[model samples]
Target: MDNYLLLKIAHSLPGLLLLLGLLAHIFMLWKANRGGDAAVLQRKLRRTRLISLPLLGVLALSLPVSGWVLVNLVGWPLGQTWLLASSVLFLAVLVLGLLLAGRLAAWQALAGSPAPASLLRFTAAYAGLIVVLLLAIMGLMGAKPA
Candidate 1:
């Protein structure tokens, strides 16, 4: 296989992993939220964080490096409109993701108590932002301009 193929796979795999991880994390959170036992909810939240955080970090780091390699291999200029837009969206996603993580930490800190309604609303909003940004980035990548 060529370098482009290898790099493309490297770039794409992380995206799939990130999407699945996010979905799973959200599902776990939903389940925990629905359960009445505070101790059970806390344990599930901690477990989800422990598994998701490292995966998120790895996906976040892998994306740019692999994307840069793929861009170089294709000889696409960095200033191209699609690439520029994707980069901006990527950064936005990162910032939003960090904010969501902070919110999760705050949720975790609520240990024995139920998560506040405001915090749940914020988490859902942040998660929606991340999903929208990610989809925009995917669109840009798929519709690479001439």
Candidate 2:
């Protein structure tokens, strides 16, 4: 197989993995929250964070590196609007993601204590923004405008 194809696969698989891992984490959190057991919630959140966070970090790092390699291989200039937009969006996602992870870790530290309503609200909003930004990044990548 061609090196470009391999790089494309490496880049694309991580996108799917990242999305699936996030959705799974969210679902687990929702389920844990619904159970109304603080201990269970904390445990679930910690487990999800421990398992998914590293995978996410790996995926996040690999996606850009593989993409950069593919862009070079294809001879697409880095200055192209789509590429630039995607780069900026990727940075936003990375920052927001890290913040969200930190928030989750903080929540885990609370153990059986109730979370502050403000923190919960902030987390929801932050997650929503990350989702929207991710979708936008996907769109920019697919459109690849001139």
Candidate 3:
């Protein structure tokens, strides 16, 4: 098999996993928004976290590794406009993802206590950031010049 085929497969499988995890999270949020019980939503969130943890770890590692392989081994240009824009937006999404994750943890911890009226803010933030990250994912896949 060609190395390019292998590389493409490697690039895609993890993306599918990440997309699955994101869909699961969105489902949980939808349920929560429908006034689902706190304990139920929290459990749903935990399940999503468990499903995503390994996939996300793989994503974090593959990014730099694949970028190096593409630009160095395969001699793909790092100076392309698409690559530059994608890189910038990807970094922004990554930072926001980290922040949203921390907030999710805090909200999950709060699940053990009383449900607060203020968790709506966290929910809104998480959803918004996730949408941005999802858009970043689409951008990475599309690789269109900006």
User: Over 4 Å off in model 2, which ranges?
Assistant: none
Q: Over the stretch 84-145, how does candidate 2's per-residue lDDT look in tens digits?
A: 98999989989999899888887888888888887777777767787788788878877874
Estimate, for each residue in 1-146, the C-alpha lDDT of model 1 and write its tens digit: 98878888889889878877787888878887887788877887787678777778789778989999888889988999999988998898888888998898899998788778999999989988887888788888889854
Query: In lDDT terms, which candidate is top?
Result: 1
List TM-scores for all candidates, in order: 0.94, 0.92, 0.74
Give stretches of model 1 more than 4 Å off.
none
TM-score-superior candidate, 1 or 2: 1
- Enumerate residue pairs that collide in model 3: none
Off-target runs (Cα >4 Å) in candidate 3 are: 32-35, 49-51, 112-118, 140-146
Tens digits of lDDT, candidate 3, 1-146: 98866776776665556656666676666677466587777886686556564467567557656655655656667887767776776677567667666666676777656556666576567657766675676666577432
* Model 1 lDDT, residue 37, Cα: 80
